[model samples]
Target: MHKFHKSIFREYDIRGVVNETLYPTDAYHIGRRYGTLVDSRLGGKKICVGYDGRLSSPALAAELIRGLKDSGMDVVELGLGPTPMVYYSVFELDADGGIMITGSHNPPSHNGFKIMLGKDSLFGAEIAGLEKITEYKEGFGSVTKLNIKTRYIMRLLQDCIIEDGYKIGWDPGNGASGEIVQKLCKALPGKHFLINEKIDGKFPAHHPDPTIPENLEQLAELVSKNKLDVGFAFDGDGDRLGIIDEKGDIIWGDQLLAILAQEVLAENPGATIIADVKSSRLFEEEVSRLGGKPLIWKTGHSLIKTKMKEMQAPLAGEMSAHIFFADKYYGFDDGIYAALRFLNIMQNSGKTASELLRALPRYYSSLEYRIPCKESDKLKIISDLKNALKVKKASFSDIDGVRVNYEDSWWLLRASNTGNYLVARFEAKTEKKLAELEATLSGFLAEYGYFLEV
Candidate 1:
């Protein structure tokens, strides 16, 4: 029996700092356990594996592959590519399951595995179940190399409606998508300026997370210097995206979603659209105004994708830039595909990115804040905050967290599923109500012996 570190098995994925909390041994056990589980469910146990450009990934992947073969599962290796490419490989190769060795947007020192069983995302309790296995059955399984990047790129271009000539800047942040972006830019129309096209594990350019405004500075400058019509940025693994307008100003996830909604609704009226709880209320209003059904769901790429399938949503997005489209493609979060769709809207409408956004209503909002709290205490803190809100008889929705609705403002407090922290946001029509909401949230956290730096 192989022992596994409890911390490495997170709610969404298996993640930890390399060589410390997570090691090659942990990866091997994970592969062994997951392989055994999948082998029992499928007549054929062919699993596809891919890794990002991390310093430790190649070694970890080798060890994981050995364990998979030992546990009786055939392996289809997709050498090196983004996490989404691995997901595509599962579909392209018709494998029983897939695993992507990636750190996502985490720092270079951290790494993890994103898993899928068949087409279902392995998360939450399913990820935790890997640790309880005490039996190991070995069978003869094969290993093969499958490179689907050419086919994947073709698929990305299949549904793209490239219309007009516009200068665009693209930044891959030297993550796994770097080389793919180079290939994509060469095929797509327009004057494309590419940056960070070399995959470097150290991320010598900047942290590969596009959600942070600071990370987009390089792309923004490129847009300004080149007089580009728009700019696009991708997170480390290429499942998340960031956009910059013509003026070099950042177009946040909510605003980008709203703009894309306009294009989608124009073609398919009354289609259902989904967004996470952290999205702006104005985005929902805009969707309704465009004759689409708007839904607010929990934050997490896997959770959003599952909800989209359940509701038959043609489109869905999170405030963190995880956009899913079932309209003309597989319902999965793909940053490059989303960027292409945004280009289609711009070309078809003949409108600037800034002009398209000016049509939507705006509100005063706070940057997403992550406050430190022990993993053991985060859920309790959220529970205590919810109890306090209930006692106050506050109007709120507890679907994922406590999203309290006030007369002129709203605030959300939720425990992060991926990390040991409480995530929060506040929005209001006026600065006064914004401050009041912040104060109110601060008071609730104080009651739980935790403090939020608003």
Candidate 2:
């Protein structure tokens, strides 16, 4: 009997509330199954493992390592660090695959694994297959402890090109990236202010999600009080970034992507730049105007990275702040690396963050609004809604979700791949049009026993 909590296996990664949905036993099984797949099919023997600052991470990692070793997969334990460091470890050590034990932006009570095999992220059907494999092959495999912190930091700072003096603020939200952020601040040539730099799994200051406005409050306050040039915040695992400007203005993920795109497109014209369907149309248009091809794809880090490689795109980002850069670095989402790249862009431009973002044409848009729905019902609602739109002869793109294109704006309604919720966002030329679209979406939702709250 090889039973496991099915809910933990999401579209992107495995995540669950610690000790409840996820247990040490689950980690062991995951390692056993994943290791078997690697050894039997992928023909890989060496694997790298790393964990975040979450309370249960250490125990989970230990069990996972034991299982991996038992399955005859040599384990390279990378110890405590952000998720990206683990990604880097795989590449640096030339390991066959890597597994990062991180909850990502989830709450402190949550913990899980983000997996990679030979530069490929495992999700969807690949993750699901782990449950079906009942055979657990046992053998004695070696475990090696490696301190990769110094090497990781040096690699991150390698491409950093910043002008001598500029003050900036940073908040790690007491997540896994704290120690690295502290070290990075010391190495850089500028006045660096940081908060919540201690790697406390409890996340004592606030929740680690930077996508939510409230979580950026501490960084915003610090930027304002110190009259700093800008501020950056990281999610729980440090794979995503949240930025605030010198004036304490929140620069949403798309806006940050747009800014970065300008610089990247300048160097490599006609390059394809990808963004998630949840991003602003303005960003897509900006990419086109900057002599680059803009592609709107599904919202997931794994999906985006895969697309980036396929399109040979130099850059790609999502509204959730998972920015991938193949311009100078590997195509992986690393908030710390993105921050350094952004700083380099700012330094070269010799302009304030406000000036850079404000110059872009403004469009009124709504934040991601979630409508509660049962997991089973969520996709069915979307399917029904798609049918309704088709009957009405609506112009929309169903690439990932249904993004209906209007004359002056667009609206997107997509079932969340990671959870049991329908995520929506709308944009229009004016508030009146926005209101009308909201009503239109609400009408569709009402028929499915759901309502839009925003």
Leading candidate by lDDT: 2
lDDT of 1 at 292: 97
Question: What tens-digit string does per-residue lDDT give for candidate 1 at 210-288?
Answer: 9899999999999999999999999999999999999877888887888889878887899999999999888888999
lDDT of 2 by residue, 1-454 (tens): 7577778888888889887888999999999998998988778879999999998999999999999999999999999999999999988998899999998888888999999988889888888888888988788899999989999999999999896689999999999999999998889998999899999998899999999999999899999999999999999999999999999898888988998998899999999999999999889878988999999999999999999999999999999998998998889999999999999889988889898889776888999998888988988877887898999999999998799998799999999988788899999989989988899999988887899986
RMSD of each candidate? 1.3, 1.0
TM-score of each: 0.97, 0.98
Instruction: Give the C-alpha lDDT of model 1.
Output: 0.89
Clashing pairs in 2: none
lDDT of model 2, residue 108: 88
Q: Give the true-structure RMSD of model 2.
A: 1.0
User: What TM-score does candidate 1 get on C-alpha atoms?
Assistant: 0.97
- Winning model by TM-score: 2
**What is the overall TM-score of model 2 with all chains considered together?**
0.98
